[model samples]
Target: MKRVLLSAFSLLMCMSASAGVTFNPDKVKAVYIVRFANFIHWPQESSLKQINYCVIGNNQVTNLLESILVQHQVRNIPVVFRQVNNQEELDDCQLVYLTPESCRLGELKIDRLGLVTVSDERAFSESMGMVEFREKSGRIVPVINVDNVAKNNITIRSQLLRISKIISTPQGVEHD
Candidate 1:
């Protein structure tokens, strides 16, 4: 099962890479944003009403996700998209995606309440967040920081861990 998932992920990476530079990055990212919600296990304490997705900066990615996920449900939970223009917006989101232009870890309080973080920054899993979407070989792939993920009290599915390059290096990413 692990191998199968890994191969599927590799195929996706290859396909994404082969896609021309004109490929809509936001669209692909939106697909992944939704998938992440499906693959991760949020804390049981989370509200069952909906899955809150916090978008910080990158209005293009934010808008794309909002449009795509508005009608979708992950694990039977309605996926709600919310814009994070300030720290106060971070209070209620379960998933957080920080655009490349968004503020870095030091400048913001991301560790609050075990937020599952995803970012476009390079090796973000190693220092800035749990999952990172990096462009490699002309493809966008996800890397996960296992240690960081555990620290947040979140459990990463083996399928996702299989496809993701797990890193444990500490580059100053903090948590509560």
Candidate 2:
């Protein structure tokens, strides 16, 4: 099962590279964002017409994700990327990608529900975010805050949890 997931991820990377776009960390992060939507179960996912991937700021990864979503989806629901500045705009967002600046600006304190917050900002997972992309051995690793996911009534499949660095709470990290 792990191999299957890995292959699917590799295929996504290959697909993006084949599109004449150069492979970069942003591209990998974008791919992970897409895969994350699949691994995590959102409330009323099937009832939604589409999945909204909200970004707190305009950046390369957001652009790459927009392009990637043009060809991919979450459980047949088309994934759309939107630039969101405040909590009001994040209402229908199933997932949100935060920028480093957003983190530094205390945006992490947002007490929103039903949103899987993600970021590449270091220690973000420890700071109440749902997931943080950490660079390890030149690869991007997902550090998931299981507590936060549960807080929002979201569930990350065991398959994904098994492969990720799980944080049982905001102050600690535990391996699956």
Candidate 3:
């Protein structure tokens, strides 16, 4: 299983080697988001027949997500893309992408239950987002906030955690 995940991770990274046009950063992030669906499990009660992947930023990632509607999926559910203008609308989203500005507010009104919040801010992993992307050695590395993820009632598979740069240490807090 670890080998398969590692291979998949390698494939995803290879698929984004070229810069925008050939390999867009937003598209890369979009791919990561889609890949996330494969490993991040929401509670059964919170899982939906249709998952709305939203973005608070008006960036290329938004456009990239649209392309995955045809390439990726979650169980029997359909994957979709949406532009969110406010937190209230976030309730309908399973995954929400926040820009630096949106994450900066630090007072996201969106409910944490079953939601995967991703950001690109430096302190995003330490503060608000469950997952974050940062440039490291010329590559975009993902950092996860394990504590916060559980706080929001989201479950992350260990395989994903093994591959990600988890920012949150075990706090002696148990998770279900």
Candidate that would win on lDDT: 2
Top-scoring candidate (TM-score): 2
- Compared with the true structure, the alpha-carbon lDDT of candidate 2 equals 0.78
Per-residue lDDT for 1-176 in model 2, tens only?
33454585786545544467554777678878878877888877768888888899878888887876764566677788888888788887989998888778784444466688999988888867889988665566788887888888898888778768888773666755
Tens digits of per-residue lDDT, candidate 3, 102-175, equal: 77675677547788888786777676678888777556777888888888888888877876787663542223
In candidate 2, which residue pairs get closer than 3 Å at backbone N, Cα or C atoms, i.e. clash? none
Alpha carbon deviation, residue 111, candidate 2 (Å): 3.7
Q: List the candidates' TM-scores in order.
A: 0.80, 0.83, 0.79
Error of 3 at 61 (Å): 1.5
Encode model 1's per-residue lDDT on 1-176: one tens digit a residue: 33443454344445643455355566566667777876788775356688889888865777877876656677667778888888888988889999877846457778754689888876567775888877666656677777778878887778767766667757633332
Number of the candidate with higher TM-score, 1 or 2: 2
- Per-prediction RMSD in angstroms? 5.5, 4.8, 5.3
Name the candidate, 2 or 3, with the larger TM-score value. 2
Which runs in model 3 stand beyond 4 Å of their true positions? Answer: 1-12, 15-24, 45-47, 169-176
Q: What is the C-alpha lDDT of each candidate?
A: 0.72, 0.78, 0.72
Backbone clashes in candidate 1 total 0
Error of 2 at 88 (Å): 0.7
